[model samples]
Target chain A: MTGIELRGVEKAYGGNKPVIENLDVQIEEGSFTILLGPSGCGKSTILRMIAGLEKETAGEIFINGIDMRGVSPGAREIAMVFQNYALYPTMTVKENIEFGLKNIKVPKPEREARVGEVIEMVGLTEYMNRKPQHLSGGQRQRVALARAIVKKPKVFLMDEPLSNLDAKLRAQIRTDLIELHRNLGATFVYVTHDQVEAMSMGTDIVLLESGRIRQQGAPESIYSAPKNLFSAQFIGSPPMNIIKAENLEHGGASLPPGTVSLGFRPEKVIVSGEGRAPERGQISFRGELVAREILGDHAIYKFKTAFGCIHTKTMSGSTVEYGKWSVRVDAKYLYYFDEKGDVIK
Target chain B: MRSQSGVFWRTFGKACRLAVNLLIFAVFFVPFYWMFLTAVKNLGQTLRLPPAFWVSAPHWENFGKVFDAIPFFSMLKNNLVMTFGIMICQFFTVIPAAYAFARFKFAGGRFLFGLTLATMMIPAQLVFLPLFLMFSKMGLVNSYASLILPWATSSFAIFMLRQTFKQVPQELIEAAKLDNASEWKIIFKLMLPIAKPTIVTLGLITFILNWNDYFWPFVLTTNNAVRTLPVGITSLNIVDGGVKYHILMAGNVLLVAPALAVFLFAHKQIIKAFTYMGGK
Candidate 1:
């Protein structure tokens, strides 16, 4: 199994401020680990360092338990799929996949067999002779996948490989990639800024902010028990809402010392209708409806309260009208946070 | 009435464009037409009134006489060697220099590239005297080295090829590197194949410029044994009486025919190169 570990990685371009510093991360073998962060947060930088494409200023990277200090990208036993697919524009689909085999002196018969098997895996056998420019975007993406898969490296690193595709194609390829990881059983280090993608595709998610890891765990654990305000807001689709703790009722029970904010997921909120009040021992806020978003299966309603603005998502077909409304969530679902945004369990 | 007027103006515009195109074609074609006509004309026909567009008695022997007037075959061989020597050498030097300029960002890179562009501004005539003196000092004045070595690498070619190389995406090279390809493989198999149009354009330009050159070889070599055909044709001018224009034109036809054939075959690539690289 090919696991990867980065200890104390630091990166700076020229003499400027470091883009990433003192970053440590571990990717378990055969796990789909997502380096999830916003743009300029150094997620891609870490992936590049693991691939040996970019040199880390200070760190030791171990791939498959081997020190990768001076190993070239080719010798690292890893294959990379770039964001743009990066297929050689001058080569046909077959040539692009077979070029690496030819470079390593793989026997001609084996090379042909490997290329054929991989091309069929990506369903690009019919377009084997077509150049990249002639193929459509989805086909080109498949060819890029075929090129990477034919290498059969111990580790696979993908840097937002599905970002360039349309939404429908991206979803389809995302499913394909999950199946691919399962079949190959190879470690995959994927970098993406989209939290939805991170939540859905990753087996182990490493949430990053700037250069530091905010949290690292399985997707369900991170989503159910966010460690901090950033993780709470980063994981969910409209994210968790946090309001100032002052003047908010907490069932008359005392909060932990230094607790300054209250948090709850939008889906956890129960929008009160039929003029009914909140249930006992639940935290409630009174506000007027400000906005509405109608999704196919559900709708998100925004409200403005005396404390602050918050949102509640509910199943569709609910006739929640405009004007004064009260939404509440059980006290157990509420997350309390300190002044510095760290969660208080 | 307005639609009829619009049709009239459109036809008028097409007529005007056709007239201008034909006029431009004549401007370029008349020189070749006159050269071929005079090459096949006798001495008296060359000086006839209105400059006879058609040769009455074609003097096809004039082309054969060109051999007797000067060492045409030897000079022809010299021309071929010099042109091809510069081309093969230029190809090697330009690809590496341009690749470095386009791909790397070492210290002083900007200044070095600026210096390359600066060399293109200086006139060749300014250096011809010093070049000839230097070659003579080295005892290489009459050798093919003096003719070919001076133009082994062209700054214009480097600058042009650098622009073309820059347009190739950086990801292509990085992908090749990750594929375990050697640097030489990345260049010969990848960069060279991608930049084919610009390279072919450079080749055609190099051939035409070297084939038509007269003054540089004239100042260096004293005899037809070492000089190119352009310089060799000078000996044909002082025959019979004074300046035999017909025979001089016949030698020029032989010197120019090969370059014309090369251009006719590869003009498509030339146009493709200029169309893309010119806008940049």
Candidate 2:
């Protein structure tokens, strides 16, 4: 059974322009599905629709096979962790955790037990009596997580929950979330603009742009086999470099018809000595070395070529000279896109 | 050397601020001091030339004379009923209205809020004549309802609360909804507590405005049976006979005491509330 399903869902504030236009998504049971997109891409809007916080302008949503057309958010049996960690300011950590249970009329003993268990799970046992103001940013985030989990909702939705934390703390919480997802065995739909978070934690990734799904697949598959130019550029840091097919001087390889753009990941380019012979089905370009950025373990070398600026990632300890250099790209690693930006299969 | 100059400048600024504040306090404090002194002076001493700064023998009996001149207890009762009644009714009306203005998206919401604000600009004198006629037709004159009904919905209170409520993050409301809390629970439990300081400030403002209101109560009520303290105190100013200056001052003192006590109790909250408003 699907944990959550959105069929032809459309959301618009008013007038004719729909933010999310005729979208269909199915989150498989117990899978960690990530809604990944840049800001204002309507990823948070989709999460809100599923939680019944915002109504879809058209179409149906289902949770556990139950239609959620007019269901209140609470009745949908979905819990959401907000970016702001919206723990009730007046309530203590314990009260915030038990708030939903009390509202749903859960018995006293079970509610307390569940609150205690979830609090312990989040490692907030010592800070249970403190209000949200007294807790640090990370601690408040844990309280929000515990509050959502205590309800034991069938699905958990998080809207950039770790974005507010510092880098180290975000990483720590990301690992914690993954482990929690494994232990709970419940569907988790996380929304974030951070590609790193999506790649590290998501079992299935749905990439969105301007409210439309660009690609949906496992992290590795999306990274390796991006279906279009947007997916290629959006999924990677220092994004995929696109070189117009006209600018590239191919090494006697037959070009596909209707190919307007050729793309390759930064790490895919092989930097070698200028005199090295190009291997079979490999293209080589010799260009002036423009700049280099040392990123601890790896160095990114930017070169000015006839095609454009081509960035190559090499090991930091490599003793490569700074003048002219030959950069090689295997034909197999090249991605071709048509004028409409669709991949040329 | 820089630190030394910084300290000197800071102390100089502090001294200037203290001097200015003292000057402002004296301006406001002098009138209250004169009123207190006049309230305690005998009728003979009250009319003395240059006005006695302090009463030699404080006539506390003037306070008793105020009660004798008018039904003070009935007036107190009337004042409490009207002030509290308006406050309670305003709470029920304004909170939901403010919340709607702040959070809900609907057609004409902005226009209606603008209209409510527009009502605030319309002077009370402009509306009182029409309102008084309407009450007279309904035979509500000289009744607590007459005093309470017109002032029940305070536009200032609603406007202040809406601003405060808008500051509450939308995420909090969404979280509450996800927690199975109904709209009522969301307002009273979540929004209300978060807006407590503002509500207290509004309540304090409302209490003082209604308590010290002389014109409306004077126009609305005719006899001692329903007159509030401010209007009731006017009875001490006899038209045919000479005004009992000391007794009237004593009556004014009695009238001002409740508002003064309320302000003292909630001054901290009021200051905090205004600070929040200014910061926002």
Candidate 3:
């Protein structure tokens, strides 16, 4: 397993403005690193550049400490699983997994042996004779996995491989991919727009916005302590609730100077009846309950307050009444941001 | 009462549809029927006043007379060589050209594609004189090279296959590249197979068109040895300054049989190729 690095990478089509410019990124060896961003944010572009499927406008890329200039994607020792699964439609499942190995001139016996091992690893042996069109989405996705796994490349670059799978299957494959990464101990550079996939699967998350790295660190750190307003709002389900500093200050919360926005996790906020006084060193707001979304284990509450709508996630069957409610959060959990949306801390 | 009327109306509609279809079929079949009839008739029956619709005695020997009048096997060989040569050469030219036009975005790509399409719109009839002159200067006229080389590359195939190849997802090509397949392998193994229907349809279209192509080959070749079936068959129309209608019709029947046979066997594929043309 080897790490990957991109230096001063820029990408643009024709004379149009650059989609990505001067972007630098590094993936540690044996780490499941995620390139996470919104659509058109150039995460997939970066992955393609790493895989040498795309040529950057002006950049140097390295895989396993080897410069990738003039190195074809095949010679670079990387395998990619695409969003559409990209299984050779004309090939049987066995052939689809074995084609890559055969292309690199691996011996027939070795190719077949490796292909069989990967097929069994992905649990697709029974359907090995079936073409991709004949398989279900999950099964096709597994074939794509088997195709990449059989190559046994230094880095496995996946561009939203799990996005096409249904939710349950997505979850199942996520677990499988994590376990596979552990067992293979190969570097994985996965690109996805879904924050849930990023947070759940990536050991290292490189958060991106409009082609620039917003923050890069462990997924837990990126969630618990975001570097900017984008990171704060992007990582969590329902996102972190953001309120203007003036409103929070008016609601009797002390704030740092030049802090224009305040943020706190929705799950961190506590919802209680309106009559409950604010606890010491805690900030509270009184508002009418406007909506409730019961999500099995917990429910999300939306309240219309003086500043704006605020949301809180509370365990189901709580004692909060419908008409008026109080939203509270400990002062220590609140995040302060400046006018630039970067965290003040 | 409503159900009874509905059944009557449905039956009437079916009858009307059947009548229209049969009329259309008869209109198209009349030419082939006339060819077959003239092909089996003697010169006396063919030249009869008010044209006898049926012959009392069929003269099947007229078909044999066609081969004796012209170098039938040689002309057949020339046609086969020229048509299949153009087809096989097109695989060398059109597939790679169409693939490049479909996928690559080099400088002047749009203008180049525009030029390709512009050439397609110019009918081959318009280019024959200039092309014949070029071939004559190159000493290729009056030879098999003149016939096969002139129509070796087709603008129509490039356009059709370009449209189909453009619809092949870029992801598939990228996936192949990452899998260690070279560019040529991707084109031959992945793209050619993916574009099989279009290629087959194009091949059959080329076969039929060139099999019956008269003017281009006539403009180039003078001798019977290199002349294709159509030009050679024209000799049957006038042997020693006398018109032989029966023999010429028999020669035409020979020229048309192979194309018709191919169409009958692969009509489904042809229909499918056209139904999903451009992109699917």
Candidate 4:
């Protein structure tokens, strides 16, 4: 069963230009789906539409198999953790977590019990009496999470909840979020522009651009076989290196017709000395070394080849001279795109 | 040698700031000192050539004489009722109006807010005659309602509260909405508490303005039955005869006492409110 479904959803702010147009997505029950895109790509708007904070200018939204056309956000049985946490600054941790329960008029004993349990689950029992201003960023984030979880709603929507934390804390909380999702078995819809978060935490990644869904699938599948040029370049760090297929010296290798560009991941290329020979089913190029950036464990080397400037990630310990070099790519790992940037399968 | 010069410059700057502050303080404090000195002087001492800086014999009777000259307690009661009535009415009227202006998007939201702020530019004197005529036509003159009704909604209060309310993040309101809070609950329980400091500051300003107001009460009331302290004090002026400066100064001191006490206790909050405004 789908936990949430948006059919032909469109949104516009007092103008003919819709921020989101023809957005259709189905979030499977108990799955962690991420709406991934660059800033201003309408990812957050999609989340708000699902939460009923924003009205769709066209089409319908369904949550938990019920039409959400006229449903208030509270009536939809969904809880959201905002990007800034949005914890009530004047309320104590315990009060913040219990606020929703009180608003719904849960009995006193049950409300206290649930609040206490959530406080322990988020490791905020000792700080329950402290206000949000007294808590650190990570602690405040935990309070937001606990506040959302205490309600135990049908769907949980989070809008880049960990973006405000430091790098080390973000990584730690990322793992905590995955564990929390597994333990709760609830549907989670998250929005973020960070490809790393989408790749690491999402069970299904929906790549969006210009308010349209580019692709939706498991993270590994999207990373390995992007359906178009945008997803291929957007989903990876240092991005995919593209070269004009006609510029390549094919060296007797048969080229697919209408192949305007060729793309391959940086990690898939092998850099070697100038005198190296290409192995079977491999294409080799000779290029001048432009620059090398050492990124702790691995290094990225920029080379100016006959095609264009291509980047290759290699082991930092490799003893390659900074001069003329040879790089090889296996034919099976190469991607071909037509003039319109759609991948040629 | 460099560190010594740094110390010298710092000390010189501190001394200059202290001197300027003292000069400003004395500029304001002299008038209050003169009022107190004149209040204690006898009638003969007040008219003396030197204008007795210090009364040779203190006349504490002057304060009592002000009460005898006018219905002082009745006027005090009227002032309290008028000020408190305006304050309460403004709380109800300004908050909801400000919240609507800040949060909701409706037709003419901007135009209506512009209209409300435009009221602040119109001097109160320009509208006094029309307002007085309206109140007299309604048979509201010489009553507390006449003084309180005109100031029931203050544009300045609405504008200040709206600016403060706009500063609240929209996400917080959305969070409250998702938490099952009604619109009124979101306002009274959430927005109001977070904006408590500014609200208190607005209340203090409204109270002080109504308390010190002399013109409106003087225009609206015909007798001492509904007159406030500032208007009632004018009875001690004794026009076309020898003026009783001591008794007049005593009335002035008493008139200034409540406002002075309110400010002394709440100056920190007023300063904080203005600072918060500057920050935004």
Give the Å error, residue A255, model 1. Answer: 5.2
Q: For this target, which candidate reaches the highest TM-score against the unseen true structure?
A: 4
lDDT measured at residue B38 in model 2 versus the true structure, 0 to 100: 86
- Per prediction, fnat is 0.56, 0.90, 0.80, 0.85
lDDT of 3 by residue, A160-249 (tens): 998887899999999999999999999999999999989988999999999999999999999998999999998998899999998666
In candidate 4, list every pair of residues with a backbone clash. none
What are the clashing pairs of model 1? none
Give the Å shift of residue B24 in candidate 1.
2.7
Please provide, for model 2 over A1-345, each residue's C-alpha lDDT reduced to its tens digit, 9 standing for 90 to 100: 788899999999978699998999999999999999999999999999999989899999989899998898988888999999998998899989999999999999998899999999999999999999999999999999999999898899999999899999999999999999999999999999999999999999999999999999999999999999999999887788898886653645567999889899888889877868889988888787889888889888898887789988876677456888788999899999999999999
Lowest summed lDDT window (length 10), candidate 4 chain B: B232-241
Query: How far off is model 2, as Cα RMSD?
Result: 2.7
Model 1 stretches with alpha carbons more than 4 Å out: A247-257, A274-276, A319-324, B55-57, B104-111, B238-240, B276-280
DockQ of each: 0.66, 0.80, 0.71, 0.86
Can you tell me the CAPRI class of model 2?
high
lDDT of 3 at A311: 86
Error of 3 at B106 (Å): 4.7
The TM-score obtained for chain B by all candidates, in the order given, is 0.95, 0.92, 0.94, 0.94
Error (Å) of candidate 3 at residue B104 is 4.0
lDDT for each residue of candidate 2 in B236-272, tens digit (9 for 90 to 100):
8874568778788899999999999999998999999
Candidate 2 vs candidate 4, DockQ winner: 4
- In Å, candidate 2's interface RMSD is 0.5
Task: Look at candidate 1 and tell me the lDDT of residue A261.
Answer: 89
